[model samples]
Target: MKFLRKASGLLIAGLILSACGQQQAENQTPAAANGDTVGLAISTQNNPFFVTLKDGAQAEADKLGLKLVVVDANDDSGKQAAGVDDLLQQNIKVLLINPTDSEAVAASVKRANEAGVPVISIDRSVQGAEVVSHVASDNVAGGKMAAEFIVSKLPSGGEMVELEGIPGSSAARERGEGFHQVMDAQQNIKIVAKQPADFDRTKGLTVMENILQSHPNVKAVFAHNDEMALGAVKALEAAQKNDVIVVGFDATDDAQAAVKAGKMAATIAQKPAEIGQIGVDTAQKVIAGETVESSIPVELELIQQ
Candidate 1:
């Protein structure tokens, strides 16, 4: 009887091992043996546009089987500075940064360079940094597209309002520069009201509400982002002044809905997903000690009618 019990115990152990092997085979995932790691420091994950970019980066990281760390700055430059410094402390192989303030992040960029961590600035650029690469949309071109739409929709020469984004952000500066370039060429279209909304819908709503009251005849408005554009629309609706044309940037889902409903006249779309993907791809190359270009410009699209 004792001999029979020992044989039965051995049989049970063998069965368990067999099951374990089968489970391991069935539940296999991508192996992360590349010994590569990357970190993404995004300004704010609150914005849908930035969320899309994060998703793209995550997807590419999984595909590449690289360890990826992500952190949100919540639109705070100080927080962003801390997060990047922390990532560096972890000795991450590469860094992908979507800066909060183009200028404020320059020091962090320099720090990453000092640590021998190659940085690929995604969407926004940091000044005076040894960045390995920059992946972003041509903000100037996108702004120009938005401006063209605004001019076309209000061609009879009317006054307009402008809502800008973060003060030191490349997107804000470049897009504003592009819009101003076009605005400079137009004689009849006057920018009577303008303010910085900080790319927030709530701020946009409040600022636009005040602007509308003062510039009641404002024929149109150009918001740097769909969030602000949506806010401006709500302000217009609440004040019973929905007739004014609104052109938004980023082509967010809300803005697209507004466009379809004829509430928004047009929007300039950027490929946030593509920017994230390219940023990750570049990060991987840098991790492998590979050389990459200094800038990777993304395409933009104009949406109307």
Candidate 2:
């Protein structure tokens, strides 16, 4: 009878221990859950520059054993907002975005902010919302370098066309500012035609063709990005105006190839991959409760044949 009583007490203790163990397991965070997922909202994948940027982010995420969810906005502000909304629904640990439109992205950023998800802006910026960090090249400096290159090629100072990026975008505004700063200093250098191509290759081609029709004597062209620059090169070739000096930003693969073949005079090489990697790293740091700087500038260089 005493042996039976002891066994009953032991059984009760064992059951309690098992219940405690199960409760502890339930309280612990899941190994493959929220902390393991990262959301990346890219402006567009059509551009090689952004494609490389996304690849860099993905590589870094893989190295860190994190799952990255990527969404392309296709350069549409509305689509970008919707994409961020979708990512928010997935309970992403962090949000890294290359905004299609700086101002329009603020709403998405605000939503992430409300959700308590840290945001790291990559390559582009958000206007109104608080961001944990921004990772990109010094675009203004790159623009200045491009302008100087064009000026150096045309020592006598001549008419040039400026193929701007998407209107209201930070890249477009800052690059235009930097280019104008140098060009304005040179009284002899004149920008005959300045128009926005929305940083698209097709629009760049059409815009360049139209500008060529109006300003055939334009001596040089400065495009805000490689895609636009390549399109401008196409138009120049078609018009047999190959002699015009062309300077472009973003040393993408195609741009480098063009430079090697002497189709493009030069390209300011912004490290898009580095920018992307740093953005992901920053997101991780923020997720780990670390404070990062508001802005992180990647290195830039000039590439020529």
Candidate 3:
């Protein structure tokens, strides 16, 4: 009887140990199953620029042996908020966001902050929240470059039309500011018409066409991005106004090809891929509890035929 009782006790002990081991395995983090996961929220993928940015981020994440979850906001602020919320449920270790609207994205940034998830802003900034880092090209300087290029083409000053990006975006505000800084200095150059095209190709075409009806004498055009610039080119071609010098930002593949083909006067090359890569790298640093700078600027260049 004593031997049987002792045997039963050992069996119960073994069962308890086995159950504890199974529970431990079940409670293991997802990172243990794969790797640390990072979330990326892009403003939109309609344009090739943002697509390249996403690709860059994904490649870097893969190289670092990390998992990346990408979400496209489609330029909708509410959608971006919901996307962020969804990513939060995935146990992401970090977040990299390219905001659709700088101010509107603040709410989502705040949520990430509250959840103790560090955020790294890419290409655009969040106005009301604290971000561990910001990675982007010098948009203000690029804007100044674009304006100067247009002035050089026109020389003695000519009426120009400006196709702006989405309202309330840092890219639009900074670029517009830089462009005006140059234009304000040169009394000979005047902006005949300026309107927001929301950084979209279709809107750029429609807006440029509308502006043309009012200011047919416009000598040059400056678009906040390549998408808009390409659209402007379409409008110019449709109107047979091929002589108008068009300057664009983001020397995307199409834009570079356009410049090489002499369809565009010039384009400011903002290495969007590099920006995306840096954003992910910075997020890793933040996750590892390493100190990082508040802002990191990517290089920019001017491309001409």
lDDT tens per residue, model 1, 217-261? 888989999999999999988988778889989887888899989
Candidate 2 lDDT (Cα, whole model)? 0.89
Clashes within 3 Å, all models in order: 0, 0, 0
Task: Tally clashes: model 1.
Answer: 0
Which 10 consecutive residues of model 2 have the lowest summed lDDT? 26-35
Error of 1 at 49 (Å): 0.5
Give, for candidate 3, the lowest lDDT window spanning 10 residues: 25-34
Q: List model 2 lDDT by residue over 56-109, tens digit each.
A: 998888766578999999999999999999999997999999999899899999
**Measured by TM-score, how close is model 3 to the native structure?**
0.89
Instruction: Score every model by TM-score.
Output: 0.89, 0.88, 0.89
Candidate 2 ranges with C-alpha deviation above 4 Å? 1-35
Model 2, position 282: C-alpha lDDT score = 79
Q: Against the unseen true structure, what C-alpha lDDT does each candidate score? A: 0.88, 0.89, 0.91
Candidate 1 lDDT score at position 180 = 94
Candidate 3: where are CA atoms >4 Å away? Answer: 1-34
